[model samples]
Target chain A: MEMIERYIYAVTQKLPQSQREDIGIELRGLIEDMIEERVGDGEVKKKDVEEVLIELGSPREMAIKYRGTKRYLIGPELYDSFLIVLKIVLISMFAGLGIVFVIQIIIDPVEILDHFVGLIVTLVTAIPQVVGWVTLVFALVDYYGGVQTKDLGLDKTWHPSMLSAIPDPRRRIKRSEPIVGIIFYVIVMVFFAFSSNFFGVYVFNDGGFREVVPFLNEAAFSQYMPLVLLLLAIFIVKECLKLISGKWTMKLVGYTVIINLLGMMVVSFLITGDAFWNPEFMSDLVKSGIVTEGSEGYQIGETIWKNSTRIIVILLLVGLVWDTIEGFIKARKK
Target chain B: MNEQEHIDKLMLELRRGTITIGVLSQLSVPQYGYSLVTLLNEKGVQVEPGTLYPLLRRLEKQGLLESLWDTNEARPRKYYKLSKMGNEVYEQLCKEWEGMVASLDHLIHTRKDEEDGND
Candidate 1:
């Protein structure tokens, strides 16, 4: 009896809950009728039930069969549409987070980016992220009818409906990646070289660098930034590609965003010059253990939240140009 | 049989079956799913549940069938019958089917006589 019930539940598992109980009962009756026709009625016991089910086929297959075919937009129909929306949303979310981070950075002890640049950056990041998320949700809902099971693992053949992802064609001819990578790399190298003490801008220029950097308060940020900025920008681009192309090849974009934001707290300390290590900040978090880095958590979150916004836009524009160029080149060849 | 032969059989039955006539004739009166299934079954043509359901859905989607959920009963069921457009299409199918049958029958019978003489 238990086996029979298990067999029935297994078949009905794929079906929606609303229909499961009734369908289960009706199907069991049908199965019983078929069993009776095959064997004597009530002669079959629990041991024979599994055999009957095996002959019928896998429960998942039966469930799929019973649910008559329905066309999916993400499958073959609106696959291109899905990619367009995913790009827009992922970029937008990044932008929104960046604005919030910038605001927090400014509000904190050290101020950077003259008021206009700061506000502009904040707004620029906020708008697209909001728009991207809105469109993404709307498009997803319209296509899937409010049933989405988007898996974001890095290793699988599982293509999200949006991931009929074709390889970008211009990867060969354009060679923009290397140049862009180096430019980004150079930016980090410059930041670290001057920010760190050895070739100190402040020491040499007698505080000339102080006037240029709107906010530079922490020693660690001063020390770590050259390495940090290069890493952050490259990571952002990688995350955006993963998201837009539906590659599942890395950590969740959210996780990356949060982790990178921690760099902001490191910067926040640079801005405030609040010592290399805040014992109270570290100890309370380590003691209360709510978080090992309490105030610093807000700082990282703020950084991520701010930079993500700009990074989102930069990623989208770069990705769009990259894809478009790749697409154009492929089209020319074809 | 080969695909061609199967298709020929299906086409022949469809031509002779008077579905255009049967459908249009029935649509003059409002009919629902179970009622329509019963009507076809009584006429000695059996429509499988899967085929009937999908066909009904497709027809409704195509604006050829107008349907509304009639939930007054203990179990809610959707009733479907032809739309105004479906009526016109049904008329067209009836005319086309008659013309096709007349031409095919004339050819077959004439060919049969020729073959008989040659034998």
Candidate 2:
């Protein structure tokens, strides 16, 4: 009897919560029936229970049979999308790091070896982290989403009306668009987040070694780092929505408009801040002997430096408006 | 793989679908898990209780079978019977099975006739 109880416990323990009680009861009755039939009016013995359980097979095997399908961390349904996301992330990471490496080499050629080493180190460290985070997110989605592949077609509950209409070929999004958008946005994010110093003037020293004078004030830049990263994250999310939908819809357009406007507002605020530019950038260029003070080159450089933030703000606003209009056009295409 | 192993593998595949029909055929009359196993085996359809129990649950989940606990019995046994939907599905399944068997029988006999004529 104890053996029977233990066997029932073993099988039912692996099943879903709602099934546990009913299956446990059903298994107990079935085992008792098997035992009774095997004994045939003889004294109930432990050997009879052992034989019944042995015939039923191992507990894990029984549980699997009940489950019907093998469980996965990221099941077959999401596995394709997971692979696509991983590829895009890896390619983007490599491309971003590559661009930073080139810029560093150009800015300070003497430190090219150091820049190459830095790129390798970043790649080695970041690849695993990216893969881990992506895998964890996909696994979480698979677990909580409760999406079954059978629900799409195999199940009798699925109906013809549930099927989506054939999408217009002209309206269908090219996979490359979102792929490129993701790669581009990620590169931009990484540039601002980690390689902002690379965007500046390079000068030759007396020893013929190149040196850089970055334009953004490091102290002020650090303050806006969190918001910059958030906007970039939102941009990546917008691209992901496009990738998932594979075509522009009203929902996608709404999301795009909202995200672009939000980004525009944040960019405008960051650009208008006086601390966003390095105050000594112009002075540093002249002191480095690259340009003479009061010369035409100096005057031009100063004017561009002063209006740089305003120009950036205008460009960003224009980009945001264009994106919103494009989204509306694509989504409303007949 | 050896011929015997290959044949056994193919046999398992062949029996998989037919097992559902076998189980459903006997479930028109309410039967507990062990009773269905015994009845199927007696009628020359070998089924393990372990296989039958899970399959019964799945069928019930699919709305093909209705189950109730018969507590009036000496021991409380979960009895399963065909639902209204189950009956219609089972009948359709039977007709399909007959059609398949008839075509297969014709194919086998025709091949044998040609072989005999050659011999």
Candidate 3:
């Protein structure tokens, strides 16, 4: 009798609150009738009740039958899109972390082995956290019947005419390219912000490989950090847009041209300013016996180093103009 | 599968579709869940208590069956009977079943004649 009560409780608990009381009453009546039929003239016993309950099968299975079907964490309707979003998040996170680790190792060779293990552990832990959060968000969407693919305003609105809007094969930006670019720019921004000394040349001495020549004046670099960060932010946003569209559009090209121009202006301002490069770097080269002071080699090296900024600014401007023209040409192609 | 196993599987599938009509036909007279199972079993259609109870609840929910608790007895029992909608549905289902059975019978008989001619 106690077993029968427990069995009824198990089934009813799984049902909705509104139906539980009615179902419980009905189930108890049915079970008692079954026990009576089996008992016949004999006294009611635990074995008789056990036999009837076993014949009824497990409580969970019975509850499932009453409840209709099994539940899903992420149902089929949203499963594909959930996977796509998860892949994008995970791949970009890992790629960004990997590039940062590689750059850190290059900057500080002593901590190579230590940081490698730390990097792996970080990626391992971060992946599951990212995956779990993404899955939970999608599961909530699925539960609310919000996984309508048509309402997403992309695939559902596709038409034969839309084919003309597709970027030319040769001009199309691969998704991986933009993802890599975004990750690289993020690493560059973090590096320039925190570790200015890491951008110098490494020289092998009696001790070990050490950065003897600092390239950029740390104070001056710090002053321009805000501009550098803004440029990085713009680059990241542009790459993300490219990643989502999976191709170059005229709008994307316009954004690209604007970002490049802004970046060129920042670089030109930093280079043309007298405080950009470390004057000590050239003096350090003379002291290290790599070049003698006032020698032809020293003069040529300094001139090239000073004018290298101008050369780079010119080259970058040319590249930006060419890229803008290419974007327009691709947008106009059949 | 061997012959008996194959037949058992086929019979199970067939019985699944027929169980609703079988229970509905007998429920014209008031019967509790266990009583209905016993009645159907005695008539040679073995209805499991687990399957029958859930099905009765489902039918009651669908408005095809009406149930009441008979608490006058020493033990209370919930008795189910066919509703007016249930009776009409049952009659229609029976007519469809008869038409299907007649057509199948004729098809089988004609197949037997063709086999006899070939022999």
Candidate number achieving the greatest TM-score relative to the actual structure: 2
Q: Which runs in model 1 stand beyond 4 Å of their true positions?
A: A1-334, B1-24, B68-78
Query: What's the DockQ for every one of the candidates?
Result: 0.04, 0.80, 0.45
Every model: iRMSD: 6.9, 0.7, 1.4
Q: Which candidate number has the best lDDT?
A: 2
Q: What is the TM-score of chain B alone in each candidate?
A: 0.75, 0.97, 0.92
Interface RMSD of 2: 0.7
Fraction of true contacts reproduced, model 1? 0.00
Off by over 4 Å in 3: A86-93, A146-334, B1-13, B102-119
Looking at model 3, the pairs that clash are: none
lDDT of 1 by residue, B1-119 (tens): 99999998997687446543564556656675556655887887665332344455556667887877666854455666788998888878878878988999999999999999999
- Candidate 2: where are CA atoms >4 Å away? A1-14, A32-61, A64-82, A99-121, A133-170, A206-209, A265-269, A272-274, B1-9, B72-75
Q: Tens digit of lDDT per residue, candidate 2, span A114-201?
A: 8889888888898998788678767876776536553564687767887766667666788898889888877887688675676677
User: Scored by CA lDDT, what does every candidate get?
Assistant: 0.52, 0.85, 0.78
Q: List the residue pairs that clash in candidate 2.
A: none
- Best of the candidates, DockQ: 2
Give the range of the ten consecutive residues with the poorest summed lDDT in model 2 chain A: A144-153
After superposition of all CA atoms, the RMSD between model 1 and the true structure is: 17.9
Report the C-alpha displacement of residue A253, candidate 3, in angstroms.
23
lDDT of 2 by residue, B1-119 (tens): 99999999998888887999999999999998999999999999888988999999999999999999999988898999999999999999999999999999999999999999999
Give lDDT tens digits, candidate 3, residues A1-334: 6788899999999999998987788788878878878888789999999988999999998888787753778776567656666666666676667766876775577899988987888777877876776677667656654444434544766777755545568668776776677667656654665557657666656765544567778877788888877777676656655664566677778777887778778877877788877878788877766789999999997998778756766887787678677766875565
